[model samples]
Target: MKLPYAEIEFDDTGERVHPGQVKDAASVISREKATDVIVICHGWNNTAAQARDLYTRVVESMHMVQGEVPGAASRRMVVIGVLWPSIQWADDVDSGAGAGVADEQETLQDMIRARIDDASVADRLVELVPRLEASSTAQEQFVALLRKTLPASTEGEDEAAFEMLATGDVGEVLSAAKGGTDAPDALAAAGGAAGIDPMGVAPLDDGGGAGFFDSIMGAGRNLLNLTTYYTMKERAGAVGRNGVAKALEALHDAAPDARLHLVGHSFGGRAVTAAALATSAKVSSLSLLQAAYSHFGMADDWDGTGKDGAFEKVPSRIDGPIIVTFTRNDKAVGVAYPIASRLARQIGAGLGDQQDPYGGIGRNGALKTAASLPAGTLLDVGGAYAFEAGRVSSLNGDAFISGHSDITGRQVAYAVLTAVATGRS
Candidate 1:
């Protein structure tokens, strides 16, 4: 079907858009004289087809909103859907594995072993196994081994390298090994008083020397999960900052006067925010639906200026409202996000406190940071509601929204369209 706005598809890497295609897309938007360009970013675990389906639904629902809201239909609109490699294989390790694997624990260990072997850390793993078995606290020993074996500096390496280790740089080195070259600095900056350990595992009972292997295996599994979680987080941020950010800049340059509205779900939230933060173009509205990014990402300042959240200065770039939707029903963000953040040592250490240093925007909205704006509005969107301009609005998306992937709902589309239509004036 012919879309109202020119449809542009980005690859998983978010880097390899054909020059001709880009020119064609720019021409389409420029020739259409679109006053408003809406960019949608999909979250994790979505294929290109799924992302397209979601974009279609959202655009259709926006049309419905236009039909209802006066003057909305008269506005010329352009839609851009961003598709990236947000899905991590480790996320589905437990569920995607075949039923034949009776032991999930063994499967997790095998996955970790494979990752280590793939990274040429098999010899290191072998060496650590004995240390892990010998140590009274297997978990601590395993963590130390990971810190010791992984490379400290990953300046230009394409793959994981264990060439050298730096003193007193365990977390940073391990972060770089798990994620990429940029991870060490990013992770180090994020480090502070550990909040809660979301995936905090208890040490197995010391069975003298008999249960040593079992203990090591458990610690291995936990370590693997933590490493994978952090890697995914860093990857998402990297894609947004590097690849997606460039694309958005190109789009902005093509249609400088166009009113920009961004919609991002799950990790796509991180992507869009990164794009906004990086771009000098003014954003009309930013809508985050079950955003998996830190709740304080858009804060003005956090923790006495030691380190800023991902989107700390985003408010200055946005000309209109910052809309955030959160629901307790989203298990992925509510449960998994915090745990992952804690495991990565991004937040203060326990399950989570009421303040929720590790909580996601999808679970808790902006929290303390929501008050940063004078006109900041927080509401429960159990029914139809209207949002004002130049404000940061947090909506309770319980009634209409189901969960993380529930971005295509009529209510959500209406909220987005309303935010755009209102901000245009």
Candidate 2:
């Protein structure tokens, strides 16, 4: 279905694809005399169509629960859907499904093509994949190429560990990926919850020795996924901080009286938060659905090292409550964050779980922030919430948020509306 809301898109470098769309969406607010502007951002989608579908589902769910929010019936709200160049990993790339070695090599090639923008670099990377299982020289060259292709990013908590991508032993890094999280059962649980087969990683020793190149091929795939995770994370932040922030500023100037509500899913959550941090736009509410960022992203001093989180200033910028949803059912964030820790050389049994210092916000919740309020689990459609303004509320969505992409549910819509209502003067 075509997106009913105004659409704004950005390129990989955070430049607006169509600069006029921001003004056009702002004009929409003025024409409709919208009292509120709901901006929804999508994360890590392969195509514009998938992103549009997400926006449609979210708006549909919100319409169904608007009545439950006080004063929502009288509100005239216009929606904006933000799109960016985000890529999704191929299922088999991480799953390590029991496919033949030739099939696995082909799968790795497909993954490289999907995530890497430069065709030549991606082709070179693909060539290295087959050799990964047999040659250390090929392994070194692959890691170097991967590091050189990715954009320079400063989003991680450990700069030294992140720098290891460039300077550390290439062999050890790939080995860490081989020893990374093995969670087919976790994926199964997530799939069961979502009623769909979840993306996952299978053990290399799953019988028959798999193949001669199985273990090294698995390591290459995992490294690719890990690097892709960080790449998308940085790209999302750039898009939000520059393009989305500019759009919202334009909208705010055009419709000064309208309250702005920002809602984002996955990496989009980081985008919206980054946009809010960058712009002077007066945001009334924020709803982050299964966001993929550090659990300590908003923390003032998560490890007592006197260092603040990357988004330490976000909570104060919003005038209303920031509602963040988290769940264990999200295998994407679950598996990715642990690999992130492993890449950073931080090892622990609970690497990606809530107890881990390196957990993603979607797997756990916003942690160590001064604005954090009493935590609550995500509620049913008609359930009540005591969301307070100028605070951060971490709502557990384990009961309802079955998977990473399962954020367009009725319960989530209700929570968003409730937060918006709570922000009203």
Candidate 3:
């Protein structure tokens, strides 16, 4: 099917794979005389087909529910989808040997070799994978190599990432990666519960022979998952700040009078937020769906040490309301963020929930922003929203958002359309 939207592709280094594609998209928006442009970005672990499907479904949903908002159905808006080189977080470890013995090892090896910048570190890490569960020395070596492989943390929230990597006990690293068992309901919602399970790895302990994550290989898989989490985080930031930001500017240059609305899911959320901060164009609104960023990511002073979030200036740059959809049902961010929190030494129950210092924006909502961000529910289709310009609204999506990828529903589309319309004069 011929998609309704144009696409901008980016490489791993944040360079445009096809620069003319962006320029062409810009020309179309200008030629079409669009009044508003909505740029949607997909998060990590998506294939090219998956990314296209995401854009297709989301745009379809928006079109299906545009009438819910006043003037939305008649709005002159153009859609642009972003495609970056984002890999799966735990594809290697998720299937384990059950996926295939030689194939599993080869896949893990290929992933490690591709992601880790240092050849020596990647080789050593891959060699140690086989012994991670049985040998303490192998586990220790794996952790040390990973510590060396990852770039040094520069943010206040990431201060403990290296510390977690530097641990001598592989079990502690695994436990940290496990992110504790504080919220059983979230796990159930993830597919272990009574409803949808988008993550597919939610029910780790279903009492079925120690489950997959409890096995010896599963222990090793935990460390691999942690490594990819950090790797993808860095890659997403690069693609957004350097690639998407430039695209937004190009779109603005081509159509200076058009209003720009940014929408991103998971790591794409981090990317678009970074783009908003870097671009000179005036952004009308931002819709972050289950964003895989820190809850403290936009705070001016989350630590009280005078340090701010990585994207602390984002809210100031957005001209309209910053709409964030979050829920405890998202196991992707729920599991990963708590590992980061545990690295920061914020252990115990509720590690990835709203109160944790290192909780994810997707798992909770916009937290510790400079302004007092209001909290509300992610209303149903045709529901009313009292969104104010230049403020942040955290929408509780536990009722509607069943998983991380549940952003393409009519209800979510309505909320996004409402956000775009709120920016209209």
Each candidate structure's TM-score, on Cα atoms with residue i matched to residue i, is 0.68, 0.90, 0.84
Per-residue lDDT tens digits of candidate 1, residues 1-425?
23455544555445645545555656777888888888788776546787788788878877766666544667888787776655433322222222222354445455556544235554455445544435545434456655543333322111122222223344443332222222444332332212112322211122232121123343354455444434445555666677666766777898788787888887788778877887666788888888876676766555564555556677667777778888765656643443343234443333322354656677668755643443223233233445655566787777767666777766787677767877556
Model 2 residue runs over 4 Å out of place are: 1-4, 89-94, 180-214
What is candidate 2's lDDT per residue for 180-239, written digit by digit as tens? 233233422222222222123334445565431235666676677767877887888889
| lDDT, each prediction | 0.57, 0.77, 0.73
Question: Could you tell me the C-alpha RMSD of candidate 1 in Å?
Answer: 8.3
Residue 304 in model 1: lDDT: 60
Looking at model 3, residue 347 earns an lDDT score of 43
Indicate which candidate wins on lDDT.
2
Query: What are the per-residue Cα lDDT tens digits for candidate 3 across 1-425?
Result: 12246889999768999989988898778777888899999986457888888888888888888777876777777899899888665321243424444455566577677666667878887897677556878767766777674655544476675466654355566544443332233432322223221223444555343344444444444555566667777788889889988888888888888889999998899889989999888899999999988888888888788888988888889999889999887777765554555454564345567666768899879887865367899999878898877788889999998888888888898888898988656
**Which residues of candidate 3, in runs, are more than 4 Å off?**
1-4, 90-130, 166-175, 178-216
Error of 1 at 163 (Å): 19
